[model samples]
Target: MRITPDTLEIGSTQKRNKNETLETFLKRITHVSLVGKAIVLMENLNFCKNLNVLYLYDNKITYITGLECCRNLTRLYLQNNAIEEITGLDVGLDRLNVLHLHNNRIRRITGLHLLPSLEHLKLDNQRLDPGEQLEFDGECLLALASSLRYLTLTNNHIKDISPLEKLKSLESLDLAVNSIQDVEPLESLLSACSYLSNVNVLGNPVANAGPPVKLRQRLILASPTLTCLNEKDIPQVERMFVENMRHAQRSRRSAKDHNHTRDQTTSLGVSGTAGVATPACQEEKPFPHLPPFASQYRDLMLSQLTKNTATERRLSDSNLHISPRKVASAAEALHRD
Candidate 1:
């Protein structure tokens, strides 16, 4: 019944007691590191019943094997290896919480539903081509949806994330440097996964569509419950302000469009004006009995009108002077004198 936690380092030499059996070694070691040994197959690991953490990264392991008997395994690091498919992990490692399989050849996500306690699953840069998208098995994801919370799929060429809609318990998700082009899937995620508050979608096509402020506003509006986006916290007041600004902008744009359409219609109706005097034309005509000065200053007024047409003149009280008619009368009097 005496249990002692100890770490065993099996270096490149793979040296061990010549007479020690695998069962005896397994019963003694709680952590093991066989990193960078060019090991291909995962053998001699079944006897590690007390093994809680195993690091086998930077090797040539083609498939996931060994450790089938390590029921107490909690953390397994198999990153930077040659794991093409995610298999061979069964119910034995049910207690596994952190599993790092990044830099491998895993094209499809599978064989992970067996780990009911898995929380963090890292699978970034899984040997995918420049534009190739990573695929996932729906059933496998649904199985992990309840327990898996922190998941990283960076640089995986993932475009569609509909399969993650069932991850209601997921809290933090990293999809940075991916090929995602739409934010609709993330909106669905926010609606489905209530606990998902932190999300990273940087370096994606969707994030580059607009300015940072506009993109952040769109994301916040899409997911009001989000507390963190692209590593930045979304304060409550900021969220409210962004939403209000978006609403106001939409209203202004709609009003401008409506006014423009109305003006176009009015212009079309008043196109032909040979005998028809439009209201605008009638309003500009001078009164008949304004004296001979009105006719004399008509050319000056027309010149002023032509100049004003190029730009809008802001009329203020400070700029007001004698009426145009009075000015015209004074000029005529001066000429007569």
Candidate 2:
């Protein structure tokens, strides 16, 4: 049966007056909630001209159709269904900001490039054949580069998330319980998507391969914004640990550069007297290209904090279970006002 105007009037949370008929109530309604009602077809929803959000999940809906007129629709929750493909969404969903299509049978992702305002897209846990991974459309990834942020692509048998490099504005990524064996793509994402803060790759082989603490530290340092890994919250001590390491690296680099410059000046020295010598070197203005995360990391990088490797030592104590409190205590004295 079609999602008729009467069905919508009944499903909507907007209270219809006793005197109001189904036909009159449907015209003014802005949202519809038709969950687990044994709905078989997605038809007759165009009557709600001012429709903004649609919650039509947990039903027997097979195919996505009949949403061609929802131009103002911003959020669509159609998860936990038998939907086999991603269709009927690109027609007039330009303003759609959120789309939840997880726990379905959609094998390939398409028609998402049309959503210019999409920010959160969840396409996880797809029902696929054994050993089959969910596929993506390349154009869709490029279109989601600027606006798309939070993404959850879990349990799709996906071994690679290299396409996520294009989603520059992504803040949180959940790739849990997948077949991802290599984290090089995730490592690259730290630079590509500087806004990425929370990542959940808990059940992946890469997360279980190496030392968990070191892996956490390496990823945190790479992005400077990552505060959560495998569902564990990263505290201030771990962040301070990275800052100290960064400072140590910068110091070593500065000293090495200074010594190299001094050697170059010594090589170009000119003898003036028996014990006096003159060296010449050129001086100019400085220009440095900073990463996108520099300003975004201000809340993380504190200026008053002195650099120390105490937290680093604490992390070395356990490769598996990292205690942020213990790590923080190692350098607690330095943080006192």
Candidate 3:
């Protein structure tokens, strides 16, 4: 393959020395699409310290460890790679703001906690799932707590977002297709981040969401300065809900008092009218059966006698202790006598 000077690509500056640094060559190459595992070697790209940006997309690179040498790297695109974990990134890359780690197999969000200068981060379409959620504490949110303003967490397994409350400066939080069920976890966060104005929670089931208000609506209604991109999406305020809550509480209190009163009355045996009050023992004969023709007259006459017997029973204090058989036998003997 012989090429003339006229056919040669311009800006092909080569060193006169036989041992030219790979950093010098890498420096010359502004954007390189690293193809199938050819080992894009910049073993010691020490001279490329001034390199501001590097795009290593679609490479078979399994790890991100050796990049600690790239101290001055400001923008790095490592999207669509075979990387499983993001480890070796140095905090020295303070100027690094944008990182594209979309379309990777990265499981946990552990090492990236130190990227304080990062502003825009994309972890979309990754292998994150509900069970494989970022089992993180507030430290991860605190890491990007201040510096991050924009974030895309679409298609991840993030469930509880209680950790995001510390991202006080976040403006755009795209959590479209995550497994977040409760919005209260993000409530304190929404209240804290005054800069936050847009929240994408469309794809998530409305049932899993927390509160009567959606994320966007809650932020707008709560914050005087916050406004949703679409105001119509805000839910309507139902006065019935407030009334129902108040009524429920009142009913519960009334029911408790009623039960307490019933228990007290039952305990005191003051149950009126229905109570069986036993009277004193009396030597009264059972009344004789009257003729059938005079039955009506006998009934009228016996009504008064029955009332008197009931009154006597009520007056007696210990009648409940006397056996019914003894009372019946005594009444028969009295009648016979």
Q: List, residue by residue over 1-337, the lDDT tens digit for candidate 1.
A: 1111222334212435689764576566777777777778777665567778888899898888766788888999999999889998875678999999999988999888799999999999899766677899998999998899999999998989888887888989999999888777877777888887899999999898778787777778877678999999999999889988989999999999998987765554444233456587333334345456555665566567547642222222112223555656666775687
- Give TM-scores for every candidate, taking all chains together and pairing residue i with residue i: 0.67, 0.72, 0.56
Ranking by lDDT: 2, 1, 3
> Considering only N, C-alpha and C atoms within 3 Å, which residue pairs clash in candidate 2?
none
Candidate 3 structure quality by residue, lDDT tens digits, 150-267: 8777777677776677788888788767777665655666778778866776566543455535444444544443434322333334334434555798899999999898676554
Lowest lDDT block of 10, candidate 1: 312-321
Instruction: Evaluate all candidate structures by whole-model CA lDDT and list the values in order.
Output: 0.77, 0.78, 0.60
Model 2 lDDT at residue 291: 39
Give the top-scoring candidate (lDDT). Answer: 2
What's the TM for model 3?
A: 0.56
Residues forming the 10-long window of minimal summed lDDT in candidate 2: 313-322
Q: Positional deviation of 152 in candidate 2, in angstroms?
A: 0.8
What is the lDDT for 272 in model 3? 30
**What is the RMSD, in Å, between candidate 3 and the native fold over all Cα?**
12.0
User: Which regions of candidate 3 deviate over 4 angstroms?
Assistant: 1-47, 207-216, 229-337
